[model samples]
Target: MTVLLTVLAGLGLGLSLIVAIGAQNAFVLRQGLRGEHVGLVVAVCAATDVTLIFAGTAGVGVVLERAPVVVDVVRWAGAAFLAGYAVLAARRALHPGALRAGTEGARVPAARVLTAVLALSWLNPHVYLDTVLLLGSVAGSHGGDRWWFALGAALGSITWFTLLGVGARWLRPFFARPAAWRLLDAGVAVVMATLAVLLVLRPV
Candidate 1:
């Protein structure tokens, strides 16, 4: 019973940390909506989160806390990437493309998708701060149960990403129109631009 409760606590915290309107989530949603390589995108995000959570439970957060410069480098790189992504989204919004459901449109190479997702997953410093530092520290508080906490966190991440990627197909009807795509792209642009600015001002 105690172990189950600890796992649940970790799950809740993991979900709380990720269920936000950030660059990573935005990119995932976009890929989900497009129905292009959703599996790969979700896999990368979930795997990265799980790996970092476990690393934190293993006391990597201590190393990170002692190395502020690493976080700064990621912050700057992430900001630049987000800024560039914002520009691309803005351009897409200006000239909205047709919504491609499943295998309906020109396929984006899987390799390209892989690269984009990898960048989005690794470049963001918040991933380190949240999964590595916050989650790690929290897991450590559980001592012997820390592994259970990490497991719960990993499960939370996997469940969320899987649901997000798979469930987005249900909204295909709504995204069928070019106008809807335009609106989504515009929102993505705004979100990415705002996040980029925030990272610059308060790099975490």
Candidate 2:
């Protein structure tokens, strides 16, 4: 029962941190909506989260916490990437005719999608802060049960990404319209831009 509670705590905290609107989640949603390489994208995200969580649990967090420069570098790179993606999204939103619903759009290369998702996953400093530092700190509080907490966090990440990628298909009908694509892109643009700015201004 004690182990279960620790796991639950980790799971809940993991979900709370990851479920928010962010560059990674936004990109995942867009990929899911396009029905293109959703599995690959989801796998990359979940795997990255699991890897980071475990790394943190393994005491990597202590090393990273002491080196603020590493976080700053990631922050700047993430900001640049987000800003560029936001521009692309804004352009897409402006040209609704170029947009297509479901699998109707021009096929993007899987390699390109892979690169984008990886950039989003690895470049974001917030991931290091939340998944590494915060989660690691909390897991340490559990003492010998820290691994259980890490496992639960990993499970939360796997569950969330699987549901997000697989469940996005249900919204295909709604996204069938050009207007919906525009709205979605517009939202993505705004979100990406906002996050980019925040990443630039916010200290970790």
Candidate 3:
């Protein structure tokens, strides 16, 4: 019973950490609405979480604690990437591309979609701080139950991304119009830019 509670506790904590608006989540929503490359994006997010959770559980978080420079590198890189994506989103807003649903109109190349998600996953310092260091510390403190905690956290990632990626289709009607796409892009642009500025000013 104690173990079950611990796992549930980990699950709740993991969901809390992840259920925020961010670059990765925003991109997932966009792809989900567009009905393109949603599966790959979800898989990338979940897999990245799995790797980080396991690494954190195995005590790699301690190594990260000692190496502040690595965090800084990711910080700057993430900011740059976020800024770049923001620019792209702003451009899309200005142009207002058609939001075709379910394999229609024109398709964004699969490689491009995958690359964007990968960059969003790896380059974000917050991901490392939250998933690797914070979660790792929490799991480690759980001692013997650390693996179960890690598993719960990993499940949180899988569940959230899967639902987010799939559930975004519910917004398909709103996104079907060019005006709606423009508004969405404009919002994404703002979000990415704001996050980039925040990253520069205060990393992690």
Query: Highest lDDT among the candidates is held by which one?
Result: 2
lDDT, candidate 1, 1-204, per-residue tens: 999999999999999999988888888887898788999999999999999999999999999889999999999999999899899888877753432332246788999889888988999998998999999999999999999999999999999989888888898999877788888888989998998999999868
Instruction: List the candidates' TM-scores in order.
Output: 0.95, 0.96, 0.94
lDDT of 3: 0.88
- The top-ranked prediction according to TM-score is 2
Q: What lDDT is reached at residue 121 by model 3?
A: 95
Query: What residue pairs clash in candidate 1, if any at all?
Result: none
**Segments of candidate 1 deviating more than 4 angstroms:** 97-105
- Judging by TM-score, tell me the better candidate of 1 and 2: 2
Q: Tens-digit lDDT track for model 3 on 21-107?
A: 999999998889878889999999999988998898898988988999998998999899999999988887776342233224668
Order of quality (TM-score): 2, 1, 3
Q: Which model is ahead, 1 or 3, in terms of lDDT?
A: 1
Residue ranges of candidate 2 with Cα displaced over 4 Å: 100-103
- Tell me the tens digit of each residue's lDDT in model 2 across 90-134: 888887555542236578999999999999999999898888888
lDDT (0 to 1) per candidate: 0.88, 0.89, 0.88
- The per-candidate count of clashes, in order, stands at 0, 0, 0
- When 2 and 3 are scored with TM-score, the better candidate is 2
